[model samples]
Target: MSLALKNEQYANELWRYKNTAGPQRQYFRMGLAAVLWRFLALHEGCVAAHCAVPGFGVVTTVPSTSGRDDHPLRTMVADMVGATRDRHRDLLTPAPNATSLGRTASPSRYTSSALWGENVLLIDDTWTTGHHAQSATAALKASGAGSVAVVVLGRHLNTTYGDTATHVEQARLRRFSWDACALRPWSHG
Candidate 1:
């Protein structure tokens, strides 16, 4: 199930906050955590409750292609959901010398050999083509994970069409001011 539309200003802000590196990254990370927390709370029956049921062994994240061991989205989701760092394992690694899989690509960019027999709940920052998630899930199952479920912060959508592009532009302009500092609540600790 999708939570946010990629074209919306809030979602664009989230994507930018996640992908861009800067001083504001920390703030956006926290804001994203808060937003994700609220979303899970609202959809507890589907997300949190499902997790609470026994048999789900651990909560992990889709490994980032950036080569960073620590992913903000993964860490934040783990924190919000009460998953310890130990429980949130990085089971998958990027393929040998593979570069960032921009927009879309085959799922073979990642490889995993870790063994897990319990259920897994995978969290990701964004869903573009879902190749990342699909690849991770396949690896998990192949490695012996009983089952795998995915939750992503945003679903990216193409806005090339005239009407959709115009709507997205309007939403972006109306929902956010140019000066991000003014939007302190989203960044507040």
Candidate 2:
């Protein structure tokens, strides 16, 4: 199970900061890592059970289509889980021609190699349509990975609702409140 819901105020604030392209993004990334660490601390039994499994070699992340050399979540998760980042680096890569296909469209736009017989804990920032995670898992399995388990920071929610008794309108929804998670320090003032 994922740690949190993206529809929540704290998670949504972090998501917005993640999408921002500036120095502040780094701070948000650090904040996110701290939040994840706290969650893991609160769920030590879950972490212990996952760690007890044999052959759990390393942690890796789903590739980003933005062509970044590395994803912050990958690095942060590795640090939190006590895994070496470089060991699983380059395991999964996004195809050059990959496009941002929305949820419900699972495009084969990922590739993996050199993962034979390795057990990987795959991480992704958010779980949306899950196309990216599924594609990464399939590629890893096909490339002979012993196993792949996925973890996400948040699960995307479809928050829109019906306007009338019988008709539901699918409209974009945004939440501006920042009082959901007490750990979050920032707010929309």
Candidate 3:
């Protein structure tokens, strides 16, 4: 679910070196909690067998490609209440040959545990080009996942980059609402 945005104006202070676990980290987690609830509720009855536990099998974050051990996002997810915390797992790790894998999608970017056909809800903190997220999905699928869904927390919008400035301008007209999804599903469009 590519629903949230991490724009500079509103979502600044997101985990930088000096300000690890940014001042507004709680807000981010709060928003994520709501988002996760909606997601699980919507997909509750649709989960299949061997999907780990109750549902969605497990909620795992994409490993930091930069090799930062024990990334803060994992801890944040681990502390989340309800089903999200209960279903968390450290499933994937960077592959042995994952060197120059840049902003291009490659299934071999990551290696995962034997899923044995579990439905996975893949979480990523920020989505820059979707390359890493997509790669993770492919890796999960290859590792015998049944259904894979990618939930990007921050669909980053670099205002100065290409059409993003225009996109932000257009988005400004609509008020942000938790009740309404930021990015509508295909059927709605």
Candidate 4:
């Protein structure tokens, strides 16, 4: 399936309702997305991926498609978390796992120094496909992010950590070691 479609499907399968407004739901959504971001960063072995701050809302850009503008997966992530857009640097370089993955984090007009604000969260409501996350991450990386991650509210059961809630929980646990929470999913058990 297409990344966009997949993201939608994943979002639908993972979430029963859209509770972006509730404090509990919002926290959980951001937390879940943050967890996924850390997981991908550690799994991908990219230092740039480690430094994300999991934003909470949507970031809309390019190719305005009617309802697509409102896709939960695309609309729910916060904004860029830490680094300001000015921090980003437009350099065409391959992400650490570029070889395994056909896509690359090449430079683009989205370049800006403020893009690399402090630890930031590229939040999303759900993960039906991951296209939204993928694109957002690439943009963040290109904008000069030391690390970038796409946080989402929900994930598929097959991909969920399952009974290892404790293990998974550890990955996201943080104690204000820095200005932003260091949710390193890779270290989780």
Candidate 5:
């Protein structure tokens, strides 16, 4: 479940500015974190409403492959004072000597320590190609994590990039609503 779609001035700018170095960087990151805080506060009852699992036992964010010991996104989640604070754990990291992890979904992109079936709630600031997020999921599963649910802060859309413009046009034709559905990652497990 994503909080919202991000493009240009929407949630994009906040996400972008949060990464670059500066004095105002913390403010931008806080704004992005606020979105997550609000979502959990607003949908307090629906996260695990109809899902098989009781609730998420652990929360994690995609590790930045850029070699930061603690990615800013991970830091944002870590600094959260909300209920998510305790559940957050630094669970995944880029695989040792991984290659070709760019737009493609490859399990080799990340690695994690063995888990004891902790249900994981994987969060990411944005979803571009989803290669990083999906790869993190694969690594968690391989390491024995259970029922990983992905939640993106934003689904990035570049109107001028490839077929996205057409998809954006098609999406705009529909009316948005609050109706939500739960996607259980371990439906078949």
Candidate 6:
């Protein structure tokens, strides 16, 4: 997932900014769809929903690129729902954002029969500003869902280039560890 999110070179300007806006995060969600399904135990009782914005210009919609096949996010989602065969339906909500990465359209355009008879798990790539999730949840409710929850791969930390509001004030942090390479020039103890 980090591989997809990483750029070889990050600018000082880009570094200081936290992108609460959400496009990148959605991309991350797409990348992590497999793990999400397994984690949620999403087999038969619920449906998975994908948010469709008209012009966001995402190159790949599938989340996984394993075994030489890149399954689109939609495909992975369908698979997750399928794993729970007869358990739930899968719905794709298409709301054309006014522009790529624009705020989600009004919920008035959405209807719920797609997921009405069952619970739903709203799936997206990221959750920074959370506008998309909020709008989608409201739409799902209007559509008659019994319940709705969200699953995402990463949370936006508001760590923009200059401001560290999310990381500092919100206390969102990550820790990493590494083991020495087995090929190292040291004798075994």
Scanning candidate 6 in windows of ten residues, the lowest lDDT window is 56-65
lDDT of 6 by residue, 105-180 (tens): 4564333444433455565455556665666666676766655665544444434445655444433254321221
List, residue by residue over 125-164, the lDDT tens digit for candidate 4.
4454455456556666656554554444454333243564
Worst 10 residues of 3 by lDDT: 180-189
Angstrom error at residue 33, model 6: 3.8
Model 6: lDDT equals 0.40
lDDT of 2 at 42: 47
lDDT score for residue 76 of model 1: 82
User: lDDT per prediction?
Assistant: 0.64, 0.62, 0.68, 0.39, 0.72, 0.40
Clashes of each: 0, 0, 1, 44, 0, 20
Model 2 C-alpha lDDT versus the unseen true structure: 0.62
TM for every model, in the order presented, reads 0.66, 0.66, 0.75, 0.34, 0.79, 0.47
- Writing each residue's lDDT as its tens digit, candidate 5 over 29-68 gives 7777786776655443355554457888888898877766
TM-score of model 2 vs. true structure: 0.66
Stretches of candidate 6 exceeding 4 Å from the true structure:
1-31, 42-71, 80-88, 95-101, 114-117, 161-189
Which has the higher TM-score value, candidate number 2 or candidate number 6?
Answer: 2
> For candidate 3, lDDT tens digit of each residue in 1-189?
342345453245344421335555566556656655665554443333233344577778898878688765676667754657888889889886675877899999998888887878888777778898899999888989878877665677666677877887887786654434433322211
Clashes of 6: 20
lDDT per residue for candidate 1 within 1-189, as digits (tens), equals 233455666577667676777777877777777766655444433543455545445767887787777777666866644433446666777776446555545456667666656877777877777888887787777778776777777776667644766765665574433222221333222
Cα displacement (Å) at residue 11, model 4: 6.1
lDDT of 2 by residue, 1-189 (tens): 232333566566557645776877877777777766555444433443554556446667887777766567776776644333444555787777666554433436777876667777777777767888988888788778876777667766544533321221222232324223323334311
Window of ten residues with lowest summed lDDT in model 4? 56-65
Winning model by TM-score? 5
Best by lDDT: 5
